[model samples]
Target: MSDFFLNIVEDEPQALSPEKVWKVAVIDDEESVHQATKLALANTHIMGRKLEFLNAYSAKDGLALLSAHSDIAVVLLDVVMETPEAGLGLAKAIRHDLRNFHTQIILRTGQPGYAPEESVITDYEVNDYKTKSELTRTKLFSAVYTAVRAYQNLTSLAAGREGLRKIIDSASTLFQERSIAKFSEGALEQINALFNINSDGIFCVSSAPKNPSPELAQYLTQHKHVDLSEVDNDFRVIATSTGYRDLFGVPLQQIPKKEVRQLINRALTTKSHVIEDHHIALYLDTPSTWQACIYLHSQQDITDKVDHEILKVFASNIALGLENTKFLTQLADTAYKDDVTSCYNRNGLMERAIPEVIDSNDHAVLYLLDIDYFHEITEALGFEYGNRVLNSFADKLKDAFPSDAMIARMHSDVFAVIVPGHGQPPIKRLIEHCSNQPLILENGDALRLGVTIGLSIHQEGTQADTTPESLIRHAEVALNKSKEQRRGSATTYDESLDAGSLERLNLLSELRRALSSNELELYVQPQVDISQQCKVVGMEVLLRWHHPILGNISPGVFVPLAERSGLAYELDLYVLRHSCSLVRQHPDLPPVSINLSAMSLDRGELLDDFASIMERFHITTKQISLEVTEGCLIKGNSALTNLQRLSDAGWDIHLDDFGSGYSSLNYLLRLPISTVKIDRLFILELKKTQHAATLLTGIIGIILNIGKRVVVEGIETQDQNDFVANAGAEVVQGFLHYRPVPFLSFVDEYKSH
Candidate 1:
């Protein structure tokens, strides 16, 4: 059944012109009617064209044939096919369901009484109504002739309206296109639709000014023009349609066809339209003094004078679009290009070059290069000379790399490049060559520059999956490694090098979960006053996290991670609020010291947030001592203000890790600190050497003399404890007294003690 429907003849095999064959579907259940219809149309001619019959045995087959051939001009439908009203049903489906109003339907019936002619014509939009007896050869021919003519006119008008719509839509879109390559391609597409031809063509623009005209002055006010002074005079093809797509960016002289080249040259030289046999070239003079030409190939001749005029108008619009696109291109260049070196900037590298390299099929390598000791060089030489050196170095990089390579200035001293893989050898040689010749400044000063290069290769299959950002990150990791080894060195990234980064990321994710899930616990270690027979003075609050999978993570490991990830502020607040709540719950416990991160003091709101938490827990400020590192005090006036605000609120701000950092005594006087805790390193070394003991003793005396209490940490053995206690340390905290315990256990132990 399918084969029978597939073999339905919609065109005459022997017809000289298939376009002249009016496609007519003869739908009926009777095989005899099909044969009779074919025989009647065999010698028939309508509107000086032959009739092509399509056979359908039933209404189902008729609808299938109509679905297969959208170009069918007329349907000679039989009313009594497969059912009583099958023919009427198919006619309604074609007009209503398919929305195909163009194809003319003529209902023919053997039984005249089955369907009334007038009602069927009005309801189903049927073109003609006839009984088989009345549909004689001449009558049938007449009916088909009228229907085919109507279909032809309707299709022609639809085509014209669609063409005009495409032109208007294309013009609006072309004005918004910023890329020259994309704009030129879209212009070719619009031109093809405007001409109603699938012809091959090329869109080319003169690299420089052609015949400069005064008419271009009017357009300059409305559009930007490219500077032609730096451009060459050759005409380059920017876009091509279909068969000529490979000719894009090629010179006009490279075109193989002499006739086409001559047409383009003639159009460009005259600054007008050139029409020839089976070809046409329209030239547009842009405001930038550049000539834009579109050469089209079509077998159909341009006989209509109106069409030629429309083509001229289209050429003018294309010229304006090209001018607009040129302005957009200039703006993009300014945004993406570095002003100092004309290389791609960080924005360009990430937005344009990196994506292109990653999306390309070929394997590529990314090289991240940093000028070693660039800050020192900039300090030695003035900034003006430094900029000159950068520009000269950029020129050398451009010279070393291929045209396809993407080079960008990622930072003040760091440059990145993406090139084809296996480029390390050439890259190494280029660096060596650059080092041999020092960059000469404007004042004839020669400055030698050293660079460290890191390489990351992206191949089809590698264990370390590469994205645009990951590739650059991996290369930067390797670059740091190179800088650590020596100047003027190169290193390649390996999976092992990135393992730590991956682990850090995972740890950050887990730490966030731990905070939310109550996996983090507060442990307290008692601070004992050594001068009063080891009396418990206060307790230090410490944070501890036990992962469900990794068991336990040390504060030393995750604390720095939290600080770097900007999570330290939240962590410190959690510790502060939780420790205060514990003290509020147990009024008998001694004062507890809560350590705060340096980052917490960066914002002014810290003091307010701390006071709010203290009020919420009903804990007094003096009951909770705030301990911050010595480094926090040197962070600027903001930290000082936060500390002063806390101290003025009657909170004791103890300087933790006092001697760990520079230990600038100026901080002791400047900051509102009431006590100092000696760093563990100093306490551990107290009994090891006499110099350590003397240093500890002197630091303790200075704290006491300054009217501040002293707490020394990490006292394990009796000798070490005795050494610090005799050294005038008021309080000592270490395993020698007690280890950090859970809040409940610490409370129980404190009560017993």
Candidate 2:
């Protein structure tokens, strides 16, 4: 040991080496203890740095000083002070309350009796515990030195955790609500941030699933030539004879593939991240697909031991974040999807289709489809089952068409599909597909559901105003014409269809005013219970609107228009309230059936409105039957919940048009409905089509099996009446039964009968 005196021959404080000074805080209750501790640790150099002593006389004062200087790194605490266990309390407070667990704590006690040896070491979350009397000058110095080194390790770990969190947050924000190009750019930026380095990166999704050795050889093209396929297990000098280090395409040799596969097999495994040499890999195991990220860097420092630990923590968080992002993306995509056919929805079409059409250099074909007589199915089986029928029909439409076709649900039982650069052959294939298959409902009933499709191709010389709305209108006109012919067939765009669609739009605008002006009227179609020898049971109300200028308008045209304009709710409510009032006015009338729109049911006010109307009219619940279609019931859980709510309100629930679209047998059990109406298509084709006969019989069997009553609609002939009666259908309604007439006309007809 050399005797040293204070020699202040030093450089300016600013010019002094930053590494030469270390600030040490000595905390003890006794002033003598602090002086003694400082004296013993004076002029000490553990790792080439001279110590400067800091003193705190009590635990309270020491904590205040510790908080002010978080970079102090190490704390020396005395166990006994004003309180017997002040040091332990301070340590607990720091670790839990102050969140300073990363800082090192060393406990020294002059009164050894106050601090138990084994308990203090184990129970308190301090770095070391010692008796101050036992701590020699050499031992004290050694303890302080050890504590500082440990704090450095903890600081590194904390920084790593924080860095990983920031990177994940940044990546997540970048990917959220982004386009494909932006997503690619964001991914590259994230990768650069992950490595803490600036580097150019490109991503390409290959047909091949696994990482190939050729990728590395391909990356180093400028350095050397190498054949990846020619060698196995043996290292071949590829790109660098220039002493450049090279690693395999995948990192994580420590986590052997066999071991990873075993870990994956053990349970529902999440993603894994691993590091090796100069690369970091991310592994994800999706059903039938294994996606991974293989990152490569030129510097060896990128995979240091400390960096490797940090990489592992980063990988775990990355896996979770990636999983969350992917799931969120899928969920967002589903929001813009049509559940039945898994096609784009109307919203999706409007967002994506118009832009695509605008960008097209070639002619694009737009085809709008309407399922002919779709109402008959929902009425026959109830909306719950009927929706399944529509879904089945939609599935057939999707399968029959090509994958590249941009298909969307434009409205209930209606679809608009866009085919870009579709020549005659592909369009013919689509037409053939539509012609080939009839949708099969869940009840094992086959619906030869006819589709009327309208096609419009934007020509090269046509005005560039081929917007999605215009294309949809063009296709719709063709569809209406095909429907008018009672044929489930395809029609290409003609100028006449465009003119007709424009007229239809004008008609819709006018129809909006019809409700307020009392232009709407109702006709009663008598529902005859044939089992009671053609006795009148209930009457179904049909809406008719006659424009003063346009003359008589079809419900088919105005009804859909009303639904689209968001006025269907008011129209439906008015009809129900008025219908109930009519029943009250004429005590001789039986229960009346009124068809409800899907949109009206979704409003959640239908039940309350119905209840109020019935209460006001002083009518019993048995006098009203609410008719709803199958398309309305199965849109989502909310729809099903609404149906349940309506059934609970005591109105007789009738499945308006059954045997039409997908009739979900499941809904019969879920819904509390009393009546199921057989569609008129089956009744109309009873004389000619064997397919129609089989479908009608199958639908009847399903209804009877579920204990629901059946009403066969569209009986226009004595033969049609005989056919429905022979099929064991309990009720029948049609023009032949008696054409729909006004209340006065109904009275006149009933009086004569």
- Clash counts for the predictions, in order: 0, 23
lDDT per residue as tens, model 2, 562-646: 8866888888977887787778877787678899888887776767777887888898778878898988775555556777887
| Candidate closest to the true structure, highest lDDT | 1
| Candidate 2: segments with Cα more than 4 A from true spot | 1-498, 616-620, 689-702, 717-727, 751-753
Each model's lDDT comes to 0.77, 0.64
lDDT of 1 by residue, 642-696 (tens): 7888888898988898788878888788778888888899976755788987888
Q: What lDDT does candidate 2 reach at residue 213?
A: 31
Give model 2's clash tally: 23
lDDT of 2: 0.64
